[model samples]
Target: MKKDKFLFLLSKKLSNDISVEENELLTLAINTSDEYKQLADKLTKYFNQRKAKNSKTDKLRAAWTMIAKAEEENFEGTFDYAAPKSKFNIFSFLKIAAVLILALASTLVVYTLQKRSQQEIQSFNTGTTKSFKLLADGTKIWLNKNSELSYNSSFGKEKREISLQGEAYFDVVKNSAIPLFIHVGNITIEVKGTAFNVNAYSGKPYIQVALIRGLIQVSHTSDPENRILLKPNQKLIIPKALVQGNTSKFDIEPISTLDLLNETKWTSDTLIFRKEKLKDLAIRLEKKYELKIEIQSAQLKERRFSGTFTTETIKQALDGLKLSYPLTYTISNKLVIIKD
Candidate 1:
């Protein structure tokens, strides 16, 4: 039942003989697997209850003895052990166990609810400009235009977690004791010291994560049972509607040079677009240039364009777009109008 492996680690931890590495492995096992976590939790309460009752090792021995005796009696069907009577009442023990189980169940339900709605939230928003932020955990984030990032004040103390809207590039520091979690809509990306780009702008068709370095585990909040581990230079895309019935929809692909550039160049104030639609490009151009762009021709809005803009003015960038695409644009004050 894999109890031996768990028992060995539990025994070491209880005896205070477990090394740091063994303790980390034990923690990882409990955190990653629901089975291990539940088993550990149950056994922990068992030992705590025994200790609280001032019971000795004989009580534990007797519990196992009762189980073994019951099994043997079932097998032999004619065994009897009517010797000396003990003070241990199985019925009373069952009542105590029931109460403990109910208490633990109640606690778990409360915890699950509280984890969703945390207080003392700290939020940052990048409006029409890219910005840099350094978290308390030493993680560096480059938030793209029109993006917002928020985390609880309990961050770095109890848990390291943040929620993101729009796009951002994260350079997370290594902290095995407290792994970082990024919540983008329904998808959650677990990071253990990695650099990644997350694009999850509202109203977008999909959410994407591009792992530039290290590793990350991506899972949907609706489909926790399904997960995808992404390595360096790998990208994962999850549909906006991540869950349909019990099915989880996602795609994992290797990142190309152009793809990586397009995903992360915005962090450095460089906008890179590849086969991007004029309508989609307009949104980014509006954010980067902080102006209104109106496409008068419906046909021109669907046209695709590819280019990079770093130190270009709004007029210069639009002129560059017109070079490859058959389009004309006029700038008046802060408004830019594009025509076919």
Candidate 2:
């Protein structure tokens, strides 16, 4: 059997589209001839190599050329001028080969174009209210509302690197040699097989690192001397530092995991607070829910509340808040104004 025919039959079988007769034919072909087995192995190797190389255009072109050459050779051997010619002659064989090549090449060209268009690098703006996911290497990353994640074509390799502007929860895949590196403001976090959350937006006053599971190492990209290793259920706070005369410094402090998880509840689309001041909790609510929350009374801002709320509508959340504090709120578009 020709390589193209074998590939067609193999693809049909793999896709579960082969008829019972075609399946039996394929089985007999493979068992009777070592050549057919070799061709199947070659096609499998080609596909595996294409995936490993990660260059779709080059691989598609190479695959089309190989298939065309194999078909031409197969046609030359299958037909004989000295043999009696039936309704199907050399012209029919050439026509079939040409049609197969044209169809395969056209299909591959369209597929390559579509894939390239979809894989283009895109940047997102979280203008006070946006949530997105950064998916790579079977890992799930939930970017908090008002947070931004930027990346280009060079993603997910020996070293997967991403720059963060706000807060995000990461479920990083396990690869000891190729660690996931996150660049947040001036700090850099290196981890291998871990789940953590990072909040380092420019508008924010402090850089926070919360490790939910696994181990992670956080260090200043500018000042290597400032390094901290965090274990599971540990948190670090990097105080906001000014860049004066090209000299910079940061103050690092450790916090409890319970507090960290409360801050990171956005990952689960839940908000939890424990006797947290209405003022302090308002800041977090705005960031997590991607809404603008304002406290009109300075004294009311100091009032504390304790409760947990799911990622519900702004109205419902505010109602829950009102139940705990003597406050009134009004929602206008994305802004939530509050007063006591």
In candidate 2, stretches whose alpha carbon ends up further than 4 angstroms from where it belongs are 1-121, 128-130, 223-226, 242-257, 270-340
lDDT per residue for candidate 1 within 1-340, as digits (tens), equals 1334555676556434467656655664564333356556765665567656645444644565565576667736544556665799764575355434434543464355346544667787878877766565557788888999998655665689899999999999898999998999887889989899999999899898898989999876766667778998888888887664333467888988788988887776667675688999999999999999999988888887665665678988888786666688888999999998
Best by lDDT: 1
Model 2, residue 43: distance off in Å is 21
What TM-score would every model get versus the actual structure?
Answer: 0.45, 0.45
Clashing residue pairs, backbone N/CA/C < 3 A, model 2 = none
Per-residue CA lDDT of model 2 for 103-150, tens digit only, reads 464346434543564445545555665353434344557677777776
lDDT for every model?
0.73, 0.65
Look at candidate 2 and tell me the lDDT of residue 152.
41
Superposed on all Cα atoms, the candidates' RMSDs to the truth, in angstroms, are 25.3, 19.8
TM-score, candidate number 1: 0.45
